[model samples]
Target: MNEDRRGLLAATAAAALAAVAGPAKAQESETPAGPPPGTPEGNPGDFDFLTGEWRIHHRWRSGPQSAEWLEFDGEATVVGILGGICSVEELRIPARNLFGMGLRLLDQERNVWQDHWVNKNSGVVAAPGEYGGFTNGVGTWSSIYDQDGVTMISQGIWDEITPTSTRWRQRISADNGATWQETWIMHWRRA
Candidate 1:
């Protein structure tokens, strides 16, 4: 096998260990007190499952407040870095002439993940990225954003995970978490 195969196998093994060990070992030195109820403590290799090429089915609105939905197909390749403590996903949509990168870093000290998006056109890391971790097999990372001068809560959810496929949804709400409108949704399958 080549180096890529070796690295992926290593990442997969590390992820298995983390899942079996739970968060106790990872959080032992970081904080004696666990995260507030319902929050999952992040661990290294949490994103190892994403370390591979993926075919993405994308759906999104034209604008944050737009009701019209557009669909496209894209491709993505995710790689594990920093010993699985970090992962980078490169996304490409040739039809739309759009490309972007997603960086997910594990905050070992805080036991959470910080997710940032970098647009190819801007070449800047978007400020105030979402922060959250997996709980009961579902991962939710969220942050606050200002949309048209109104404060909105934005969430990126990873669910319906399987060995070969997963679903990601992005939703926003101006009224706290009382209501949400899905802005983008993507179905990812191993490519």
Candidate 2:
């Protein structure tokens, strides 16, 4: 509808896609040694692979149920906090006047991560955090969200990560997890 609403929706999708896989960080520095103090037994360094500036290639549908595709570019910076147990990603998409950040925290006992997105314009959390983890090199996070009173399942995934690039996608299912419609796709490259 209006620009702010449109930007908010776009920011949500961008954050979702960005959560799947962060852009490849620079060689940068080396990690401190073992896990940080109070670190959980799970992989504390789950997000270590993505910590630096990255160039983002973004694609998504006009709406959660729309089939039309839109393309744009964005940039992101990923930083590891609490010694890799937590991470924060800042996203920028000026074409749509969107800016936001994603904060991710890991659960040591359960080994799942809770990823959250926050919009800068509204200074509010985009939605409830998605909880999940990576298995066999693929990560999938899913959560049930209520948008305007409509219940929907939101899923974000990181697929095909490599030294220089990776793929990420976001999908929503209206009926549990039965059928999913891809809402966002992102390709990240080292910047």
- Report the number of the highest-lDDT candidate: 1
- TM-score list, all predictions: 0.77, 0.73
- Give the alpha carbon lDDT tens digit for every residue of 1-191 in model 2: 24454355446545554544444442123211222222223368888777677889899899766889999999877776666777777788888888888777776666767676778877654433667677778878777767887788777888898877888899988876788889999999978
lDDT of each: 0.77, 0.70
lDDT by residue (tens digit), candidate 1, 1-191: 24675475446434533442457855455432323334567789889888888999999899977889999999887878788787777789997999987777787888887776777897665532678799888999877767779888878899999989999999988997899999999999998
The global Cα lDDT (0 to 1) of model 2 is: 0.70
Give residue 26's error in model 2 in angstroms.
38
lDDT, model 2, position 76 = 78
**Per-candidate count of clashing residue pairs (backbone under 3 Å):** 0, 0
Tell me how far the alpha carbon of residue 59 in candidate 1 is from the true structure, in angstroms, after superposition.
Answer: 0.9
TM-score of 1: 0.77
How does residue 95 of candidate 2 score in lDDT? 86
